[model samples]
Target: MKTRTKSEMNKIRDIAEDYYIRLGKKGRDIADMLGVTEQTIIAWKKGRDGERTWDERKRDMELTPLKIRELILQEAHKTLSGQKSELDADRLAKLMAAYDRLSKKTNPRTVMDVFMMFDNWMTDEEPDLVVKFTEYHRRFLFYIIERES
Candidate 1:
């Protein structure tokens, strides 16, 4: 049997983690692919000592906007690729809406961009209301900051 260094073992573990969490592979399958024992993969999934478990990592990843977007994209891709029976228009639309909502929540810059564009349009079209709009915009910005905090 060949001896593996700490770095090599860590690299293998990382690959296993990605397969199990990101690619949704089973531990036994990952172990077979990585040429490691199933027990080793199980241990890694459960976490060594104080480290976080693979399930915990997966849950955390699922909670993130980026991960949610990735999942939505994956589902869309599957549908487009004919892996799924048919294109679920309603489901896809809902997923995209959820993705947009999550994206806006994580990225305040999107809100700012939309607000700036609207403010510019208001300034040009309704010049007299600019002062009131400015006050409202200020309050809105403060509200956004408060919501974020």
Candidate 2:
């Protein structure tokens, strides 16, 4: 494809807006169709501010939730540098295991299955079960979820 001119970018923005209103597709779909990445679509969608050049176009986008997760890990690594605390150790090990499993393309432990299991377990609320689980995270997750629902 030829390098996008201002008019071409405006056209892309209009089409992208239409795609969003029609089906709420992420910019990624438009990018894929246009033979570019989602990021380029995002930038082009943010038109130049009274200028004709790409430099005036939007950049330095917000951190997505996934990227925010990485930032959180980085902050945690920096802050948890002490000899150790139980909370720090457990979280650290869990993160390391996740990173290793994922980077190696191994069968990473799935959280959705665990979510489902918790979901099923929470559906039953026998008085005995509630009292037994009162001090546990399962109780808190279930309580909060039920309240939100």
Best lDDT among the predictions, by candidate number: 1
- Name the candidate that leads on TM-score: 1
List candidate 2 stretches off by more than 4 Å: 44-149
Give all candidates' CA lDDT scores: 0.83, 0.56
lDDT of 1 at 104: 63
lDDT of 1 by residue, 61-102 (tens): 667777777778888888888787344869888889977876
Q: In model 1, state the lDDT of residue 107.
A: 43
lDDT of 2 at 23: 40
Count of steric clashes across candidates, in order: 0, 0
Worst 10 residues of 1 by lDDT: 104-113
Candidate 1 colliding pairs, count: 0
lDDT digits (tens) for residues 23-132 of candidate 2: 45677887777666788766765645764423222122233335645755665666666533434656766866666554553121133345546646775845466445
Please estimate how well model 2 matches the true structure, expressed as its whole-model Cα lDDT. 0.56
- Quote model 2's TM-score: 0.28
